[model samples]
Target: MKKSIALFIILISVFSLAFNSCSSDDDESNDPQVATGSFEIYLDGVLFKQGTNAEVGLIKDNQGNYVNTVTIGMGSETGIVVSGFPATISDVTTMDNDSDPGVNINVDSDYYGTISGTMTRTSASKISFDGTCTKLMEAQVYTITGFVQSTAWEVID
Candidate 1:
């Protein structure tokens, strides 16, 4: 009887140790990565400024769904950011000043207006957007066009 009890305890200990072992592969796979992209801003059909390294991220909406966001520039500097939650490929997502939907492109420059664009996924890790923005600020009318591409966007939040 004592021998059988000892054998059962040994088995239980071995099982516990096996279950508690940590796997590096599993841990690394679960980690989130940052998304990156690039864009060029054109003012009145002329190239005004551009960014080679932009940051793209995923944001969760109230419905617990993921939305893709593209952001460029800094807090104090001229910046342009847009968010689109495309359900499928080639879906045109739009953002405007009056609409103010969560999924909209926001221009934070001296000129701010309605930015309408479409986001297309070219590959599993790449995306491209073509859009036009028109804004009238300080009695000056500005028309801008943007061509943006994702350089590196494969992050999970």
Candidate 2:
């Protein structure tokens, strides 16, 4: 049973890896220079036991630097265990603003998110902020609870 579950997780990760970059109708900037880099996502904040599926991409910073845009995708990863399943996550959710930090690619999700008191990394790569965005029909309040030792990512490519 454990082996089967692991295999299933691996399959899901590989399948998700084939996806294309997010849609940006307009990706034009007047930056002076561009530097490029790579990134990787780890599970439970463990670089060694990272999620089977991680997000890797490049970015064009304002300074004309083209860096790899890395993020944690919606799926099962090491250390994070979803309730009611051996190891699986069902949907993917993302949030982004054209601006930087809180306004730019914060990428909140629904499947599993950072618990409160816990924090997620905002764009620019150091600060942590809300990524688990929720919608309340009546109250319209998003209670974001982050995780402890959650997804730890680094720029590696």
Candidate 3:
């Protein structure tokens, strides 16, 4: 009878250990989360503002190098796209204007420009830009400043 009781207790203990080891709370997802944020940019005195329509994440460039990008109003005709950033940014990183342009401003999908200024990574999920864009064809220039705060960064292929 004692052996039977000991065997039953052992079985119960094993079952308890197995159940505890498979806890749902301890199972964390390894997938990259989608980013969410808002941004506003003033182009030639015209204001373009979007709420919850911004995404900041890491994407691979043409050379397969990881670069940081912030896209606002992605699906809309008028938006702002800033890319060519290093995989990791410092307090205030200047925008590069070499062969690989760093910033692209799309106004009504008509005007495109390159930015000359600095980008600040305030936090892990927040970034701010302060600079000016020079229109491609025209000699027009305007101030472009904005900030994006996202819950997380979405890693894009």
**On lDDT, who's better, 1 or 3?**
3
Q: Write the per-residue lDDT of candidate 3 for residues 96-145, one digit (tens) a residue.
A: 54312345555553544444777776666556776776654556767777
Segments of candidate 3 deviating more than 4 angstroms = 1-33, 44-46, 55-58, 61-66, 86-90, 98-101, 154-157
The TM-score values for the models, in the order shown, are: 0.51, 0.27, 0.58
Give me the runs in candidate 2 sitting further than 4 Å from their true place: 1-52, 62-64, 67-70, 75-100, 103-127, 130-132, 136-139, 147-157
**Candidate 2 vs candidate 3: which has greater lDDT?**
3
C-alpha lDDT of all candidate models, in order: 0.44, 0.28, 0.51
RMSD for all candidates, in order, please: 19.6, 15.0, 21.3
Write one digit per residue (lDDT tens) for candidate 2, span 34-151.
1222233332344322223333333335784433333333322322221111011222223332111111112222222222222333333332333332221122324332221223
For candidate 1, report its TM-score: 0.51
Compute the lDDT of residue 76 as modeled in candidate 1.
27
Model 1 Cα lDDT, one tens digit per residue, 1-157: 3532353344334323322232234354332224345667666778776766554334445785544643444222444444443444445555443312212233443434334554555544444555545443334445555655553334412
What is the number of residue pairs that collide in model 1?
0
Best by TM-score: 3
RMSD, model 3, all Cα superposed?
21.3
